[model samples]
Target: MLSPEADAPLRAAAMTWLTVRSNDGADPLPRHELESFHFEGERVPLIDRQRGIRKPAILEAALSIITVYRAEGTTRPYEDGTGSDGLIRYKWRGLDPDHAENRALRVAMERRLPLIWFVGVAPGWFQPVFPVYVAGEEPQLNQFALAVDEVFGLVEPETHLEAQLRRYVERVTKQRLHQPVFRSTVLRAYTGRCAVCALAHRDLLDAAHIVPDSHERGEASVRNGLALCKLHHSAFDNRYLGVTPDLTVHIRQDILEEQDGPTLLHGLQRRHGQKLMVLPGPRSQYPSKELLEITYRRFLEPA
Candidate 1:
C-alpha cells in the first residue's frame, strides 16, 4: 500500500514504464522487469505475488488483475475466459462479491479507471495490457466484464462508424491476448532455436507463420508456425527463401545469383536445398504440410 499522494504517481509511473518497454519491443515482458519497477526510489510491485486482484490499503479502486496460465490438462484456480460477446470474463476472488479484493475491482468498474492486466504467456513470462477497464459486472455469475477498448463502455453500436469501431476493438483484443501466447508456444516447441539456421538465441527468433494470419486457415497453432531467426524470417516473408512441404529450404534464384557479401552467401544461399536445421522434438508439433504447400506455391508465384 502507498500513501494517498503516492498512489496516483506510482500508477502513472508504471504506465510510463510499460509504454517505454513496449516501444523498446519487449513483448511478453519477463518477470524480472515487472518486479524491478521503481517509483520515487521505492519498489512498487505492479503485480501481486499470490492474489489475482491487487489494490492498496487506501479506499481507492483496484490497481490491476491477472490471469495465470496453467499447463494443458491441468486445473486452473479461476474460471476466467473470453465471453461470446468478445469481452473478457474475470472471475471474482471468492464467492462473495463484496470481499475486499472483489469490492476493489467493482469500485474500479464504477469509477471507470484503467488497469493493467498481466496475462501469463509462459510459466514466468507475462504480456502486459494496459488501460483496460472493468466495463461491466455480473454479480450473479461472480464475475466482471472487461473491455479491451474504451468504446465498449459506450452504449451498444447502432451506427456504421460504431459498428466498425466495435469490430476493430474485437480484433485488437484478440491480437493482444492471443499473439504472445502463440509466440511462446511455438518457440517452446522448437526449443527456442531457429528451425532454418539452428540459431539458439530466443530473443532473435520469431514464430513465423507458414500461412499468414489474414488467411482463413491461418490459425495461431504450433502446426502452422516455424521458429526462425530474424534474418530468415524476413527472407521467408519476402519470398527470398521458401520451405517446401518436404522440409527442404529453397532460395530464390535471383537471391542466389546476387553479388552480395558473406551474409547473403553463407546466411541464405548455402542453406538452399538443405533440410531444416532444427525441428520440434514432437512429431505432432511439425508444421502442417498442407499449409506449407499453399505457402510454397505463393512463394513460387511472381511477387
Candidate 2:
C-alpha cells in the first residue's frame, strides 16, 4: 500500500484528469473517457465493468464506485445505493469483509481519502460526482457511508444532530445527486426535445418540475417533469408561460400583447395557445395532468 503522503499527488492528478474530461460535471462522460486516467506514462483504469468498486493497484484506497442503470423495462441486477438518510449506503462487494475491494473502501474511510462516484444516467453514459469520502462503515449491514463533502464525512450517522444534518444533507443531495438523474431521466423520456418549442439540443434543454420541487407532492420522476429549453423553462418558472392539463402552452396575456424584439414576438407571443411541440412517447411517461393543473392554477393567479 502506498503511504498517504505518496498517494496525494496521484489522487490530485486523477481528479484533474476527471475534471477536464467531465467539464467539471456539466457534461456526462462516455465509457472511454471514464475508462482510464493517465499518470506518469502509465494508464490506470477508473472503473471495472464487472464490479461496482474499483481500486487501482498503485493506489492505497478505492478509486471509485459505480451504480449501473437498468433500462425502464428491465430488472436491476443489484440494489442501487441510494441512501434514505441523505448519504449513500454502498454495499460490500460480497459477504467477505477481507475481500480486496471491500478492504480498499475501508482504507478510504480510515484514511479520509476522497473517491469518485460514477452514476449511470443511461446505458453506457455516466454522470460523475467526485471527491466523495467513505465516511463510516456498518459491518452488520455490510455497507459503508458515502458522503458528498468533507462536512458530511465527519458526522456520525444517527447522532443527536442527525435530524438537522439530515435536512442539510438532503438539500445537498438534491443538487449533487437528484438533479442530474432527474434531468437525464426526463430528457430521455422526451427523446431529448423541448416539449414547448421542440428544441432538439440537449445541452440547451432543462427538465422542469410541474409541481415545484418544494411542494409536498413534488416528485423527481418523469411524470412530474417536462423537458423544456432554457428560455421556456425560465418562462414557465416565472409564470410568464403556463401549460394546462391538455398540454396547451399559454403565454401571460400582458406579455403576449407587449411589443418586443423578435425573441418575444416569435418565441413567446407566437407560442401562446399552442399545443406542446413534443411529448414523451409513452403515455405513462407524460407529465402528470394533475400536477400540471396545480401549476397552471398558480400561473393563472394574479401576478
Candidate 3:
C-alpha cells in the first residue's frame, strides 16, 4: 500500500463521491469500507498504491488508482516496468496489465474494471489518467496494453520513446478531460434540446462538436458544440444537414431535391433555413460563430 500522504487525493475523491451519493439518499455509502482509506465498489477495490514504493515485496494493485511520482522528478517506474511485444508494450506503474494483481480483470473481460491512474506532474500537481481497460496482451512479444473502447497503440509516434510516451499519455488525458465536461456543458447550454428539431428527450440528446474532436481547431467548449439528437447528429456528421454560423438550419440540396419518404422530406429536407431549435444562454456562452463557420463551410463543400 502507498503512504497516507501520497494516497490522500484519491481517498478524498472516493470518500467525497460516496458521501455525496449517500447524502442524496441514493445508494448508502456507494462503497464498502474495508478500512480507513480503503474502499470497494463497482466490484473492484480502489487501491492507492505509490508508483515505486514497494510494500515489502508484495502489493495489491488490481483495480486501483496509482500516482506516478511522489514529487517532481521523483517518479519511479518499477525497474523492468515495460515488456515489449516486439512492436509495442505498455507501462502501468511499472507493472503490465497482466500482472498477477490484475488477474481478476483478465479473467472477467466483461467487467471492464477501470484503472484510474494519477501522475504527479510536478511537485504537488497531479493529473488523473483517463479510465482505461486492460485489452489482451501479446504474450509471445511480452506486451500488455490499455484502451477506451478500442485498443491503444503508437502508430508511428515520435522517434524518442520518452517523447512518444509523453504524447501517448497526454492523448488519453486530453480525451478524458474533453469528453464528459464538454458533453455536460453543451447539453445544459441548449437545455437538453436537439438544436435541429427541438427534441427534448435528454436520453436522445447528445453534445455534438461543430468541428470534430480530431480537428486541429476543435475544442471541448460550449461555444464549439451543439445539442443534437442521435438521428440528426448522424445526419450532420454524414453531411445530410448542417447549421450556419447564424444558427440557421440547412438541409443538403441533394437531400432536399431528392424525392423520398416523409422521414426524409418532412423530417429533414423541408427544415432548411429554419431558425435553430435551441440556443444556449448568457449570450457569452453561445456557440462560437467562427467554429460554426468551419462546419458550415464543410456543409457547403462538394462531397
Question: Which of the numbered candidates is closest to the native, going by highest lDDT?
Answer: 2
Clashes of each: 0, 0, 1
Each model's lDDT comes to 0.80, 0.82, 0.55
Instruction: List candidate 2 stretches off by more than 4 Å.
Output: 1-6, 73-75, 81-85, 162-164, 188-192, 200-203, 280-284
User: What is candidate 1's CA lDDT for residue 9?
Assistant: 71
Off by over 4 Å in 3: 1-167
**Model 3: per-residue Cα lDDT over 147-170, one tens digit each:** 543334442222345656655655
Error of 3 at 247 (Å): 0.9
Writing each residue's lDDT as its tens digit, candidate 2 over 1-303 gives 444464778778888888887767655677877776767667777878888889877777888888887655565655656466767777888889999999999998898888888878677888788778887888898888878873565467544456777778877877877787788778878888999989999889999999977899897778889999999999999999999999999999999889989999988999998999999877877788899999999999998
Candidate 1, 179-259: lDDT as tens digits = 766787788778889999999988899999999877989887778899999999999999999999999999999898998
Better of 2 and 3 by lDDT: 2
RMSD of each: 4.1, 2.9, 11.7
Judge candidate 2 against the unseen true structure and give its global Cα lDDT, from 0 to 1: 0.82
